[model samples]
Target: MLRGAWLGLLLTLMATPAVATSMNAFRERAVTDPHGLIDAVRQQLDQAGIELPPARERELLWGMGTAAINSNDDAALAEATLRLDGLATVANDPVAAAAAGFLRARHDIANGVGDGLGEALKAADKVLGESDPEIVAWARFQLCDAYALDEKPAKALPLCRQAVTAYRALNDDYGIGDAENDVGIALATMDRVDDAAATYERSRQYFARAKAEQLVVMVGDNLAQMYLKQGRAREALALSRASLKQELATGRISDALNSSADIARAEAALGRHREAYEQMRKVVAQARTAGINGQLVDMLKVESRLAEQAGDLRQALADEREAARLGSAVDTPALRAIEVELEQRYAAREKELRISELEHANELKDLQLKAAEADAARRREQQQRQRLVNTTIALLAAALLLIVGLLALLLRAQRRHAAELQAQTLRDPLTGMANRRAFQQRATELLGSPREANAAPHVLLLIDIDHFKCINDSIGHLQGDRVLRLLTDYLRTAVYDCCFVARIGGEEFAVLCPQAGLAAGMRLAETLRAGVAALVLPQDLPVARLTISIGVAQFDGTRCHDLSSWMRAADLALYSAKSGGRDRVEASKLAG
Candidate 1:
């Protein structure tokens, strides 16, 4: 067997160089090392004025987002998904937009973001209405996935049926197989076990015929899980081992660990306490390495059963305690019941397994024969598997070589563009300070905090460069901009640490202060006035060593919440300051 495997590997190595790779190869490599591939593709897309298809891009983006989550980055997957969704507005292609929406929904489901489902469902509906049958099937699959995540299995099941029907219409065997697996999962959730088993069998058959090893493994695992639910631990174990063989061949370590747990269940059912205990320990070790707490608890329960069967009461108690510690409050009823039944079986199945094993040997042999045929089919597909591996490695090599230059150029351009965009969004182009929109947003967020209500209430100070347009008429608008920038610099320099400052429309400036009352706000405003008066400019233009009239209001006792009211009150105080003569601070008391 080992010599044959080596010969097969040699043949695969020799055949790999002859295969043709597509853009999708690069896309998958981009997932593992995205900076290079994503940036290169982005540059190409920008130059061609073409966009990456929305669905694929969204999937890639979500993958990146998930990686960030896995790495414990401060920003969540929902935050990244939101940014990707915003990009869809300019994406240009309807199919791409639909795909993006689908990805957003998936990411949301993973991150427990409920808001993504409605838009994903709508996008799927839109795509299905306009696209080819295969595309429609895929879209409907995405929709079903969304519904399943949203806990709307009724909606999910019928849509999964629609996906399978669509795929069948397209004569797409792989699509049908995938849809069948989904259908089985949905049916099982809805208490239709017999139908689920039929669906899973059909799925496995179709996946096998299509040479879809991944789907075969997935569906096999699903069927094994279903068997576990039905209290057929022996069957579940057999199926799980078959799935593990495939997962192991494909290098899916975590999936293999899951299958090992299922095999442990079967060992326990067969009264092989020693083997079950060993398998359960391996499952826990693998799960710990993978950082998957979810399956660790189940593995512990199995260990508890093994210990109980061996009359190791202390070991059984320790295992039970560990299982309880790792278990979640949200475990499914089926899962909980399985644990109970396994415990009961451990107590009751001591004598019956020997007789049952003898009677079931022929059936097990037939199942093994079927599995051997499936394994032979896998061996026959070795050529295509080699092609996939070669394509993946070559794409990675090409991407690594191209990425540095592409990222450098793209990042340089993006930073320049971002500066311009930021100015437009948050600054007065002439005055170079935060604009009205920025002022209002920061003020609301800063003052709305309940913690700030007890700390000194935030102060809002509004300042107008008095008679600024008259200065603009005397000096050019260019000089007017200089005057504004100079005054902005002075105010920002004077109280930059304590204040959030913005240029609010033409010649108007605002400051937000946390931990500041009306008196403190007035003092800060007067300091701003003094700094502006002491300023100098090189223009030799007739602009003021510009002085500002200040109006200040502390946030206290106002039913009319939000920044607009704060601005209005501050404006009124500014007018009062100007009426009293410019270049001084006027403070307004909060209204009762």
Candidate 2:
């Protein structure tokens, strides 16, 4: 029964009008009416009666695949790519095979397949040396996108430029738009913000002119994000809202959800926290229903921050914990390993390509050398020998120089990696502040030096979040982590640059204020306490008002001889404050 059904379908396709239509007809319609072309090809693939040559059939399928990709029809694209691959195999056409592979790889990448980038890169590399200018341009554009996905913007930028130049030469406005968008992304990643914005604007204009509404919306979203990063919340909000409306009208539910999230972020940035929180709630619910865990996690994080801003601490804590759980589930070691493997494969393929080019150059050199030897044969043997000797010396010198340059680059990369690791070690991962070791080391350095006669005494403030353990127990460790991070933000803003703030223990932070007196320390501690106490949650929540207890101690050489002794005095005062009442400050009285 299955065999009969398959035979019937094959007969139906063979009898279609597409088989009778010329490839030029499809190609002409591809630019102005890609959707119509895709629909026509799809219908043709469903009917029967005509007999076309294998090459013609392959061309039809290729046209359909390209049209489907342009129209963003995944089902049609998949069908066309599958058929084109089979036909290309039967006809032994490498170019057609490469084209089919690239389409399939791009589709897979869009759907989040692990090896898609590697496959795309491989396919694009295959067609890059093709004689067809359009094919070469398309291959370069695909390469740029692949590199951008791999987070190598510097590598992607030049490829994007090349693609854009090729498209301009072909007068392919749609292709130019696509390449320009990629160029913008590469520029943005490299932190060339102004250049990126201008490129995106150009892309949008090209897309608009090409009547690619979907791509225009995509560019709008990119521009919105850039505006948000630049603190232009009003403009970001406007653009995101417009994009969201367009996405919804076009029935792009996933894109609409992303746009909504952007809108919420813009709202939050503009101080419309309640509106942002409510908006994100809807986005999170929709993302969860769609089972997009990666997007859901991101949306949940935005929602959590919005909740926090709106004084809904309970909701904020719940959202944070949920986001963390989802993130952990989505971010698996196996997934990371696959990503790394893809990157390694890409690097290996690039190395292979480079090696092939070098080998080809050497082959050409060998041919030239043979010609030279032939010419030298007509001359003196001694002159030939001297020429060969000079050539050998120059080649050896070039090889040595290349090797030295590579070694220098490797050494520099290793040094940069080591420096990053060192910085991470001295920083608290959760709070992004100095750790206990760093804090103690810095304090010791300050105390060991002799004080100037007119220099103000250094003061230390030891602060602990009130009922932080209870917060962890009630909300979970994930929320506790969020609280710590939020508190760190507050502390950073509250203290001056002259003060060194560090998270020394769980729920405990120390501030070492240089050139501060006992009175100044007490005043700063009171300000911190009041600031924390002002962090009130929603009235209906079970959580109490947030608060912190502080202990202030001024450096006294007569009473506290060393850094350890001075810290002990602060600890004593901290204990006194905790004993007196939480959310209060106490100063140490050192004996003169």
Highest-TM-score candidate: 2
Cα RMSD of all models vs. native, in order, equals 30.3, 22.8
Model 1: runs farther than 4 Å from truth? 1-87, 92-132, 146-155, 190-192, 226-236, 293-592
lDDT of 2 by residue, 296-343 (tens): 666788888899999999999999999788656534677657656755
Model 1, 149: alpha-carbon shift in Å? 6.7
In angstroms, the error of model 2 at 257 is 2.9
lDDT of 1: 0.61
- Model 2 stretches with alpha carbons more than 4 Å out: 1-38, 48-78, 99-113, 150-152, 208-217, 288-300, 311-592
Instruction: Give the clashing pairs for model 1.
Output: 54-96
Error of 1 at 151 (Å): 7.2
Q: Would you list the clashing residue pairs of candidate 2?
A: 12-47, 12-48, 15-48, 15-49, 15-50
lDDT of 1 by residue, 1-592 (tens): 0001101001111111222311012312322232343445344445644355554454444444433322223244355456466656666545546655655544443333235455565565445444354455556676665555445568677777777666555555666676677677677778777788788889889868866555566567668777776788778887888877865654444456667877777777777878888777777777676554544565677778887887787988998897776543334466446535543553354345446664586467557555655554554455346775876656554554355446556655865797689778977667667888788778777756665224556678888998798888986788788777777777766774656888877888888886666777777888878877777766576654667899888766463266667667788889989999888888864421
